[model samples]
Target chain A: AQSVAQPEDQVNVAEGNPLTVKCTYSVSGNPYLFWYVQYPNRGLQFLLKYITGDNLVKGSYGFEAEFNKSQTSFHLKKPSALVSDSALYFCAVRVGGFQKLVFGTGTRLLVSP
Target chain B: SQTIHQWPATLVQPVGSPLSLECTVEGTSNPNLYWYRQAAGRGLQLLFYSVGIGQISSEVPQNLSASRPQDRQFILSSKKLLLSDSGFYLCAWSVRGVAGGQETQYFGPGTRLLVL
Candidate 1:
């Protein structure tokens, strides 16, 4: 079965500092990876997805992720973090020819001002 | 522009009570709809998905059931709710890709269910 793992439970960073949220996935075939953000008591918002393209995929809110096939990782990254960027982040993977997406346990991002 | 809506925003019911959560999508036709439960604000567990009207596929066997009577309307219900059913329920929709690739799923605002 396809699965995604987000190792960090929470990550704390200072405002304006670079931030990275790690994500690794396991799938039988080529993986369709995605990143989503969620605020308190709100549904998840799509950030970006990696189907087949360049190694790096840019997304909304100045966030981006890199798909490293060799490493089987798709890590969300931002050059500079903001206090508003603090939220829960999730990584999901969809195996080829599958409709269901396997999601990882979310990582809480805490940005200090 | 496409959008998804779910209601009621919050619900409180007894453990043995019934449950009915409704979700509808606008500005899109023949879109795939899904029902997911998020427990303790963590990873999401897909409960059901529908490729078209009257075609419901259940991913988990639990106290909940889903029905798609209309093209864009999906409903989740249960005859008797359980304490474990208390969580955030989300409805999502995605367009089917031509090449059979996976598409991005757009989620609704979600409904908070609390069972006493």
Candidate 2:
């Protein structure tokens, strides 16, 4: 089955510290991975995506993700996290070229000061 | 630039009440429209998608129904609302097979439904 997995249910990070939210995938063909963040009572906002090419992809708000083909992972990362960065993050993936993204359970990030 | 709009930013309806949530896309033509629901802590669950006028595809089995009355307008309807239908409903759009796998779906602000 094609699915995305976020290993951690919640990630705790100190303000100004680097943060990482892990994600792994099980699919048939090349995976189109995407990351989305949701604030309280709001819709999801696009963060970054990994299609092909570069392994390290940068997204909005100084966030970046590394795509590891061998591990079938696309983990979201940020050099430094802010207290305002606390939100829920989701990892999504689709088949070779399907636009329908199957999302992971999601991981909540708590950046405390 | 394309934008999607969903109405009734928040709603509080009683169980068994009818529902009508609308979404419209501007600056795009023949786009793919989708309705997704997210529970308190659950990820998005795709409920319906429409490719064109009068064309609708359901992703899950539910009491809700969808219709594409026009090219850019999609409506989600339920004859009777259930407590299970309470959640954050989001409307999104993507260019139809335009960029292959790189297709990005833009979402609306979303409607928070509370059924009692």
Candidate 3:
């Protein structure tokens, strides 16, 4: 079975500092990875996805992710964090030829001003 | 432009009461619809998915059931609610066919369900 793991329960960072949210996935075949953000009492919003492309994929709200096939990781990154960037982040993986996605438990991001 | 909508933004029902949640999509045709439950604001568990009208695939077996009576309308229901059923329910849609599996899904605002 395909699965995604987000090791960190929460990550705290200062405003304007660089931030990283770790994500690792396991799949039988080619993996389609995605990053999503959720605010309190709101549905998830798609940030980005990695199907087949360059190692780096850029997303919304000045966020980006690096897909490292060797490491089996797709970590979300941002050069500078903002207070508004604080939210819950989830990593998902979809195996090739499947429409369903398996999601991680999610990591809470806390950006302090 | 495409948009997804889920009704009854917040619902509070008794444990034995019935449940019916509705979802609709606009500006798209023959889209794939999905129902997911998010427990404690964490990961999402896909409950059901429909590729077309009258076509429903259940991912998990629970107290809930889903039906797609129309091309863009999906419904989730249960004869009797359970305390464990309380969670945030989300509806999503993606373009069907032509990279459909690889397509990005757009979500609705979500509905918060509380069972007493």
Candidate 4:
């Protein structure tokens, strides 16, 4: 079985400040990781994914995530925060060759102007 | 290009009432379809998936059931609605990728269900 963990329930940041949403995963063999964002009453939008090659993966909306195999972590990072960026973010993982994804509990991001 | 759509953006029903939610995909053929539920303030839970027409895989055992009657259509149904079933239902589709590769899942706008 595969699983994902997001340690933070909510993260607060000021506009123009850097932000980080933490994620970790446990799975057998290689892992395929993904990041998604959801606004209130809206469907989730894909941010990025990590399959292989280049530990640093760049995603939409000026966000990026670094995959650390040693720690089994894929942390989402942004150079600066925007009020519009405040939303719920989820991290998910799947084992190689599996089509199903196991998602984290989700972290709500709040950016104060 | 591909698009997924779910009908009845919001539904309110009494307990013990029948439930039905429809989802359809356009511009894609033989796509893998999935049904997921998200409770308030929680992550998504995979309820069912279909690899092809008439082939449904259930992840959780509940009153809710899913059927893929057409290549591009999937349906979620319940014989009797339960309060526990109240949640935001999402439909998604993905291309079947090769071994060791990852496929991106595209989601629908979702249907919010409330059981009274």
Candidate 5:
């Protein structure tokens, strides 16, 4: 079974400041990673995904993620935070050939102005 | 263009009462359907998925059950609702059965169910 872990429960950053949310995964074969965001009472919106190659993956809302095979991590990054970017973020992983997006507990991001 | 629709945007039900949630896809055929639940402010939890009509896969077994009567219609049903069932129910569709890592799941707005 594939599983994902989000070490941080919440992340806080000031407006215009850079932010990062950590994610890691455990699976049997090569992995496919994804990041998604959810606003209050809304369904999750797809941000980006990493299938293979080019360790760094970029997504919507000026957010990006780096896939590190050695560290078994895929951390989401943004150079600047906006108040509207605050939301619950999720990291998901699936073994190659299997697209059942197993997700982590999720990390809450809060951008302060 | 393709879109998904879910009914009763919000539902309030009493415990032990029967429950049913419906989802339909438009402008698409033979879609792969899924039923997911998200606890308040949490990530998605896949409860059921279907590759084709009458072929349902259970990812988690609890008080929920799902059925696909048509190629584009999926339904989540429960004989008796429970408090644990209270959460945001989401319906999603993928182009086809997942084979490798390229599949993307498109989601509906979702239905918020509150079990009182």
Candidate 6:
């Protein structure tokens, strides 16, 4: 079964500092990876996705992710974090041609002011 | 300019009570709809999905069921809600890719169900 793993439960970073949220996925074939953010009591908003051809994918809010096929990782990153960037981040994966997405447990990003 | 809406925003009901959470999409047609449940500190679990009207697919065998009577309307129903069903329920929709590739899903505001 295809699955995603977000190792960190929470990550704390100061404002304007670089931040990284780690994610790894396991799938039978080529993986379709995605990153989503959810504010408190809100539904998730799509940040980025990696389907093919690109190792590094940039998303909304100046966030980006690198897809490493060898390590089975798709880690979300931002050069400079903001206080407003604090939220719940989720990594998801889908196997080839599958519509259902397998999501990670999620990582809470806490950007201190 | 597609949008998905789910209601009521929050629901409080006793265990064994019935549940009816409605989700509808505007400005889109023949989109794939999905129902997901998110437990505290956990990832979203896919409960059901529908590709078209009257076409429902169950991803997991659970106490809940889903229906798609209209092309853009999806409903999640449970005859007897359990205490375990207390969680955030989300409705999502995605446009089907013409080339059979994966499409990004857009989520609704979600309904927080508290089964006491």
DockQ of each: 0.74, 0.67, 0.69, 0.70, 0.64, 0.69
Summarize candidate 4's per-residue lDDT along B2-116 as a digit string, tens digits: 8899999999999999999999999989998999999985789999999899999999999999999999999999999999999999999988655664888889999999999
Per-residue C-alpha lDDT of model 5 across residues A1-113, encoded as one tens digit per residue: 89999999999999999999999999888898889898888878889999889999888989999999989999999999999999999998888664688989999999999
Candidate 3 DockQ, CA atoms? 0.69
Evaluated with lDDT, which candidate comes out highest?
1
Report residue B111 deviation for candidate 5 (angstroms).
Answer: 1.1
Model 4 CAPRI quality: medium
* Residue B7 displacement (Å), model 1: 0.3
Interface RMSD after interface superposition, each candidate: 1.3, 1.7, 1.7, 1.4, 1.7, 1.6
Question: lDDT per residue, candidate 5, B6-109, as tens digits?
Answer: 99799999999998899999988888899999986686889999989999999977999999999999999999999999999999987875568577787888
Tens digits of per-residue lDDT for model 6, B11-94 = 999999999999999998899899999999468999999989899999989899999999999999999999999999999999
The collision pairs in model 1 are: none
Clash pairs, model 4 backbone? none
User: What is the CA-based DockQ of model 2?
Assistant: 0.67
Retained true contacts (fraction), each candidate? 0.67, 0.64, 0.67, 0.62, 0.67, 0.62
TM-score of chain B of each: 0.97, 0.95, 0.98, 0.96, 0.95, 0.96
Q: Give the whole-model CA lDDT for all candidates, comma-separated.
A: 0.95, 0.90, 0.94, 0.93, 0.90, 0.93
lDDT of 2 by residue, A1-113 (tens): 68999999999999999999999999888888999998988778999999889999999999999999999999999999999999999999987554477889999999999
Tell me model 5's lDDT, rounded to 2 decimals: 0.90
Off by over 4 Å in 1: none
On a 0 to 100 scale, what is the lDDT of residue B85 in model 6? 97
Decreasing TM-score order of the candidates: 1, 3, 4, 6, 2, 5
Q: Compared to the true structure, candidate 3 yields what TM-score?
A: 0.98
Judged by whole-model lDDT over C-alpha atoms, candidate 3 comes out at: 0.94
- The DockQ value obtained for model 1 is 0.74
In model 4, the runs with Cα more than 4 Å from the true position are none
